[model samples]
Target: MFTSRMFAAGAAGFALAAMGPAGTAHALHSDTFAADNAESAAVVSAQIADTGSLDGDCTGTAIAPHWVLTARHCIEPFPTPGGSVRLGQGDQQRRVQVDHWEAAPAGDIALLHTVEDMGLASYPTVSDTVPGLGAARLYGWSPDGSGKTTKLPVAEGEITELLDMSLFEGKQMINVDTHNGGKTQPGDSGGPLFVDGKVVGTLSASLGDDKDGMSDVAAYAVVAEQYDWVMETISGGGQGADAGTPGRGDLNAAWLVGGGGGVLVAIGASVVVLRGRGKSDAG
Candidate 1:
């Protein structure tokens, strides 16, 4: 949860720039759909229950009708079922439902299944090839979790680097960086970063100090190369296709306790298991 001060401080500059009557109207209009109009814009949200309370955040996108791509860590498995997904939701909180979820822990990516069958019509199309130094935009609900209603804020940045092929712990990954200092915060993980209105990368990690300021770093994630696996998992089967089912060794109690951050250790194995479920059971 970001502090009110953080939200105020981050949004103040932009707010001030939009002062006065004309600015107010422009601000309202921009807040409505200006961000969604971009080729690289997508919406992602989640529902999680911790400490006996159901609370969650929004940060993700629709790469395919029934498929939404997000960060591995964002998928927090719950001891009990009842999690849900909201897509294309704007300030009003209106959204489409995603009925399923799957993830590849090795790639740090998650795919969402829509309940109502969202046609592949609105998804961003990615090229089989990677773009060099391409520009992109990012969108997500920047919740002012400081006791106020969550507000979705949008930011834009350029891709400074795109490592479509890299090895991490022996598993392949896609690394990326943006010119805009904008990044994924605690609730912003699993959002989508768009290029030319097409799905490019999932918002995974960022380089910075933690809330405690102990760890300073940069963040990245797996990209399009894993599309086949993602497709397979969403379509049902590739590797751990039985992940969603109970009693599987992969579906352990540790997932609920650790959330997405703790599952990094067995990402490779988890990816295989997660794909079987077709949706990350993690909150």
Candidate 2:
């Protein structure tokens, strides 16, 4: 639980910019039919409970039985009141209340614990290494394209750069060129970027606007860099406000600098765990 003081401390870092209502990212030039796979099963929709809203506020992944991985900014203000996640796809979608959440003391990542076990047989595991340059897949729920009336939107793209300090200060991330497949728009935030069949990054931000037909550059938080923090949070069931790691204030500071003192993007967090992808330079 992030205390008021902690939240205030974190908020102080963003004094340069005013926090606004949360928004989601989307995917363009994507195929909704290609979402039929194992990875899509693990993907969940993050939404506000009792809102009666039809779509998810953001996207997330089930990393474990009852644990979900998402960008901290997606649940801005931390632990949204009645925050819940929707599992399954299309007509099978169901919403579950979040028991609690654990924000990494450093990165833009956060863990949501469901009130009950998700009972998932298989889910997308995190990748240990980060690929320098290669093809990757993007998954998310958006109100655009077929996503508006369908399930998940899957996009195929290529990793172009590994950024360190160029965007988020002291944070590691990767840039994917979705020019071939499509660009990530609102509502696609917090979604997973897959290399092979494992998750290597979580949607963060895009270099240029996708609507204006600029560059289809998408940035993601490097998962391997925060492996220890993620596992520990889930294993320990979150370190209450008094215990565990403390310093989201630092993350907030870096985030402000990373976003160029503008409205904070809905997604922009790191994932953990390592499977394929290759040796990660994230340290």
Clashes of 1: 28
Which candidate leads in TM-score?
2
> Which portions of model 2 show Cα errors greater than 4 Å?
1-16, 19-29, 48-54, 78-81, 166-170, 179-181, 210-215, 237-283
lDDT of each: 0.40, 0.54
TM-score of each: 0.57, 0.71
Q: What is the per-residue lDDT of model 1 for residues 1-283, given as tens digits with 9 covering 90 to 100? A: 1100011112111111111110000011123223343232335455432221122443566554455566654454444323455444335444455445665645657665555544323445533345456555655443422212234555556566653322222133333443333333444456565666556666544433335321112233545656556655644573323234222122122321002222222211111011101112122
Error of 1 at 237 (Å): 4.3
Which candidate gets the maximum lDDT versus the true structure? 2
Of candidate 2, the 10-residue stretch with the lowest lDDT total is 1-10
